[model samples]
Target: MRVWPLLPCLSALFSAPVSAEADDASGITVTAPRLERSLEREPAALTRLEGRALAPARSGRNLGEVLEAVPGIAVTNRHNFAQGVRLSSRGFGARSAFGIRGLRLHLDGLPLTLPDGQSQVDTVDLDSVVATEVRRGPASVPYGNAAGGVVDLRTAEGFTGPDGARLALQGGSHGLRKAHLRVADADEAGAWHLAAGDLSQTGHRDQSRVDKRLARFSTTRLLAGGRELRIIAGAMDTPFAEDPGGLTRAQWEADRGAADPDAVTLDAGQRADQQDAGVIWRDPASLPGEIRARLFASRRDFEQQLPFVFPGAENRVGYQRAFHGLRLAYGDDRRWGGVPVTALVGLDADRQADDRVRFVVDEQRRVQEQTVDERQTATAAGLFARAGFGLGAASEVTLGLRLDRLRLAVDDRHAGSVDDSGSRTFTEPSGGLGITRQWGEQTLYANATTAFESPTFVELADPDGGGGMNPDLEPQRAVNREVGARGPLGDAARWELALYSVRVRNELIPFERAGRDFYENAGSTRREGVEAGLDWAPAAGWSLRAALTAADYRFVDFEDREGNDYGGNELPGLARWRGELVARRDLGPGGLALAARYQGRRFADNANEVRVGPRTVADLRAHWRRGGWRLFAAVENVADVDYPANIRVNNDAGYYFEPAPGRALRVGLAIPLR
Candidate 1:
């Protein structure tokens, strides 16, 4: 509360200041542009967060808790470990109920998102991550199949200076226990790193506990002729992660920690195991250009129980999936017509096959019926090229183009239904143009791009017990335009701000009927938003970070089957305003940190009924270090705010709210060995 006065004074002084020379540090060099370009000059809306900023919220078992304040990004549902984090960038992924959609996730340069535009971040080794980069706005031209956003989680390569190791232990409220170990060394074998960890929590809500274990290994080896090779591998096992489901308004008011009756009755939960490995090869320096190629493969086995049951059908489902992919890229630093140019060309391709089954549960909990037997396959391929050209000294223009083709297929083996097999393919050519001009430490930018997204096979399925795909289902498409400016705010602060709008056609919407969920395409939709972020190091021992967002997402033209003319209404899942602020004060050997977050009230369905959100929560953490050991503690929801944190839109009943956790505490220790 004391930080409020600084805002007015800081603005007034800035608006009425004399001209001065800017002293600013440049942004980091990142691969978010696929060009290994410098963030300060790159003509895109990109942001990067270092690992040191994520340590405070690492034990929450929800990624949203860790990445809460990133600009143009929204991460919520901190208490729902079962369905994973609900993350969105600029309203792109707001409709997702579970897992991640409309975004791409990459770990150690390997794609975690499948070819069908579906992804989950639970397998990421958060304890071992060193950095993360977010690419915002329409991205079809650079990454195929996702129009929302892209997140890249990078891990530590190794220690080039000396050998070191770290051991960490954690204990928290709600029966939380976590431990992690990491080691890095450099010797005659080049450089290598190893990390392993396990964590469990009997969550704040009933029937929502989770147990998970993970391991990661990475190494880089010098090859003959000055070439190099890098390898990365990961393994994960999650024995149990219960799902409490959603609660109605009355139910939420009665008890915020109680599980949904249906979820408790069915014992809803999931278990999963996953493993993946990747290899990267670099060409010799003598080659015409810098050439790098990658190969990767992954396997996942999973099972889950639904909250409801159909008498003759199944409520339990299982999945086994195999995935493989490759990426090849070439970049050249040269001049075209006496102007500096950085041009990159790349190819991406991936294939995935999933085998699924469903089993009925009778009174005795036996497999009474074999209701579903099917295999789904998806393939994607893309070719893209981008070039940046320097215009004069402090201005540049960039252009890029990508051609992508994706195919989805389903092979139904259900004996009770006729052959419901089907296949669909789509090809799209997308591109973007960007311009940036710099004046001292200030940079001005503008971008115009096109985006496309084909529905996942499951989203195209009819909810009326029909096994075949809906013939009328179609892909969603959009165009985005944005402009923004970023620069230093004196020597104590930095700011990045942007405003944009997007127009979309055939926007997908979800609906539930008789316990089955299905999707429909709206005629048109519009989204307009503004995003702002600031990092202020007011003094030597004090640091502050703030972010504010306001967006208006509305349906332009559409009507449901019941002749309901709903032409103008706010989108179901997006809130109009959101804000977050974090501050830290160092006390030599120890530090105190505080964070506050706010979300405005928003609708729970297309009809603008059942509003949720509009809550503010504060969190605090303190830590001290001496020698190679450190101890820390954290308290979340310091004010014990009561609010619905999640909404399951368009449900059969008026059960959309998911209560958030109240006050909780955690304490841990970290020891480093050298």
Candidate 2:
């Protein structure tokens, strides 16, 4: 398939590196800089897994699985291909189904969630990611609301070499198979660059399959007068299996582990397709100050089959979202009256729409139940300012403030459905203050911040009476405080420790009412915890890393209308303690490596009713390099253990979702054409 091409104007912008610093010809220094530099300057409270650490240890399916070892992070795998990971810090508890509360997800600076604040992250394939930056605590103010934290993903810009191509094909147990390929080139002028690739995999579980294809093209141009322009275009198509229900423990034991409890036969399929394009401009000479502007647009369409037993009861749910956003930022660094100060200001606006539909298969596929022909719109406008000052020879203080305005409107029309329309406007104010003290190679820091999250459409939609909607729900809010220290130990080791607490109000809860789950607001709760991690390179070719996170969370002063004191219960899906350990040893000459990893057991539901057992898995990887050619092979799940990564709560009818494949192997190769 032909994907959208990068815009010629943008392709010309990134051809050469542009100085990110501002000019001071006007006797005033403007420290304008690139977004990349801004991110690097910020302190990262969370652990980062990069390079070899990411390649061999990334087992399961999604980005969440790869990050499970991070301190205070838990991943719930609903299926081998679908996963939900949550991150908690110090005493703060994150939603089990979605990782961290007040967490922000970004793709190249663009938010990845629906305007309603819910992320449709299943579309993200791990193989295409270049890097993931995790920011812990409420210090993520610059990204807008939910600054509770942020995960930012960037794709490969393009191959810098003359030309290159790589292809990988493999088959394993459970009818599993996959193929991946990449091709890239840079024009002779070195001003034009292009890259494209595809990834396809047929899964291992019964009736579980996946076929995905993706292509990305980026170009850069060096403009005259010390400016640059860049453009990027990409598209992705993914079709995968879906298992929505779980089995009971009784049935699980009776089945003798031979039958897949999370199995089902359905008539419809599930899929998601997306196309995106973006442009960026950096003008280092405009007004003697560094200035950067970015704009992007993306269209995503998604569909899923309704889980039902009747032959013709299965329905299709789908939506199309178009998102557009723009950002303008300025920064400056200069000494005033013998004191150094750096400041930045930025503004952004984003808009999105959701369209829903249903389908039927009678001899031929056709539109049947238009159960929800709804159009929802959400717009967010925000302004952020941050200033950092040198407190002394070895200490610095940073202060940041952000103001956001969010507006949402929903219009729904289903057959005999109540045609209800409602709109709400919310103004969220959040900020953070931090102090960092550096001594030799050690850095100690303390910070405090506030964050908030608005309710989603799914939370507001009433499942009763033909799926009515709630109009009076309030947004969830949180205040987070944390203190930590990080530094290098000796020449080849690093360690970090953090303690945190969060108080949340108007928490959203899904209640079981008449066999269907509905949404409501829980009174209030408090969460506190500690997280610590260490990475050590004991030898030139060996590395070891470990992390531990523990949290204590409870409902406080919470009362229902009936005055029921349902407090002090362990919040659902909240793990009291979670940890991971990994060790890697490099084998010289052939680029070979051996790896082992272990993770603790985790609860399956918020009520803490069920628990998935702990897991210890091993992996081996070997790579060969000859000139510009490289070949690699990997063996995963060395123990071949069967464990559940996630469980469905509403599946009271007896269905259980098993983990993933066991003892799988793969190999691939890459070659550069010059």
Candidate 3:
């Protein structure tokens, strides 16, 4: 693979000479449960980015762009807002057609993933985030089912910023325009933050236009008895975001900027209005251990038009969702038999209700008929506990266990049709065991974990075009074993490396049928990979970061729907080699950053027939600050490299490629509103 040749060079870079600086590793702490300790004490593969480390990514608008520096992860589908961002951790979420699956997402300690094992990133405002922490590998024991990985976003406290409002405006290529307003203030007893923004863009591809509005508010109140109360709310409205759809290789070669003809013909696109709110209460000194509780609720009204036109009907799907959840947790730190021990216990319960409807559209895009209607409900609950026991001054053993139960029910309401109403229940147990040993200023860790991912409601949608779940669909499960080490290379450098192997059964896969997405399960699969990263401050005002991932993912035993054996075939929608390099230098009151991303060639289908070639793209960003005023500029695809942002696996029509945007430029200014 392409990444192998770069390993030697990367090794040399980490060991290169540098000046002395304070060790940042000792001060870093992990916030999430099951791993809440100093970075040097944790027994997992974790990555944390914040403050100066996140400045280079702040120029981009999506999480995919913000997380590019993290290894063992692949992020794409950036330009197409209708489809949202696609993220895959160790190839776990590679099959998603839109949104995120097989991973857990959290914002301010509130779950962003729905009860049915699906998540959307449109609801998250990256501009407001201050820290992003990612825990790689299967984490079912810490976060219940579908926990291939965990992504947590922590926002800045209202008191952290200046005690006044700020306004920012930006414009760029492809008719991009944006404006934002923020207000924040804090006193000894409380703090509040409010922000609003508007954005519009005429995309690079034909028929691809986007318009969106967003708002967020958060407040914290200090209570008596060492108690705290907090509230958070956010909303997003996208009136229209055109879906250009995927194109065939010939079509793409002719004009990468062209949209699929089918998409233009049907005016395919999506509209979404979503809002969510949460309240959290915490008490520390009043209890034997710290107690925390959170309640959250969200609603979304969404609709989408597909490119395909069946016999006498143009396809469209719409759904109204009501979701709510509650979480309660407690953490205690104490000593047992002269041995240091830490324990945590938590309960999570969530429910999702969706009113889904299928419609036939006319050439004018007006609803012509309603063919299907159903009310689907998913309720889930989990009880989890984890403990860490110090074996000695240099070693610690950690263990975690969780029990999860889920119930899915569909009530068909379509008149005069077969009442295909049915329900299914699942009960699963997940566990993890790990050991960590201190190695001077570095740490070495090894762990084994288990996870399961149930089919989402969208995945269960009858492939034959009906109102009930597909009887053949089943949950996918996996077991992962990993070992790794991380520590300071020198006074000015930090490095991490991890090696892991996973065995999976009933691996879910997606395919396209007449432009609509459907799901199926593969027999079994095997995955093994190496992930490594390095950060170095070679001199004053200069910093460099690099990450690489190399993996071989293949089917161990599998037969397609056509009875063709796909054993030993490589998985689709994943690159065997991925790497990134970023360098930043402070120039007086301004800073300049340059980045390059590399992806290796990979197959687009289970048969490994269609291939997407390897490509490297570069980007540049710069920012200057003076008092409360700031100026920023960014240039993406500086080399104008043409590549596909995503692929449709096993697409029957062979229209598998979704082209990414070419070179583009953006500039912005921020000024205090006070």
Candidate 1 matches the true fold with a TM-score of 0.94
TM, every model:
0.94, 0.84, 0.95
Over 1-674, each residue of candidate 2 has an lDDT whose tens digit, in order, gives 00112122222332323333312111211112122323223333656555555664232246654563577655455344422343444323244223234566776555665456666455454554655666666543677655556666655445443356665454454454555455655553334334444544555544455566666666767777778777877787776644333445665454323334213444334677888888888887876557778898889887765444333433456888888788888877767677777777889788887776655433334545455577888898888888777665555677888888988877766554366466777898888786665545455566677777777655676544433457656777777766666767888887887677777888765544332345566678777777788888998888877878776766665554346565765555455666676666776645555554455554544445566666766667777767766677778677876655454432334343444456778666565544
Error of 3 at 26 (Å): 1.4
RMSD, one per candidate, in order: 4.5, 9.4, 4.0
Local lDDT at 555 for model 3: 92
Query: Which candidate number has the best TM-score?
Result: 3
Supply candidate 3's per-residue lDDT for 184: 88
Q: Which structure is stronger by lDDT: 2 or 3?
A: 3
In the predicted model 3, the residue pairs found to clash are: none
Candidate-wise lDDT, in order: 0.81, 0.59, 0.85
Candidate 1's residue-wise lDDT over 1-674, tens digit each? Answer: 12222323322322333224432248578786787777766776777777445655356366665565778788877677677788888778777767787888888889988898788887887867767888888888888887678888888788542368998899988889999988988866579999899999998889899899999999999777778889999999999999888888999999999888878877888999999999988884867778989999999999987666557546688989999999999988788889989888999999999998888875445678887788999999999999889876666788999999998888999897556688888898899998777667777777788888888766877665555777677888888887777877888877898777787888877887756567888899888887888888989998888889888888899787566766889888788989998888989998898989888889998999777858898989899988878899999889999987788888877778878888989999988976
- Candidate ranking under TM-score, highest first, comes to 3, 1, 2
- Predicted candidate 3 versus true structure: per-residue lDDT over 172-280, tens digit per residue: 9999998888888899898998888888999989878999999989999998888899999999999999999889999999999899886898888899999999999
Candidate 3 Cα RMSD (Å)? 4.0
Off by over 4 Å in 1: 1-27, 160-162, 187-189, 223-226
Error of 2 at 117 (Å): 1.5
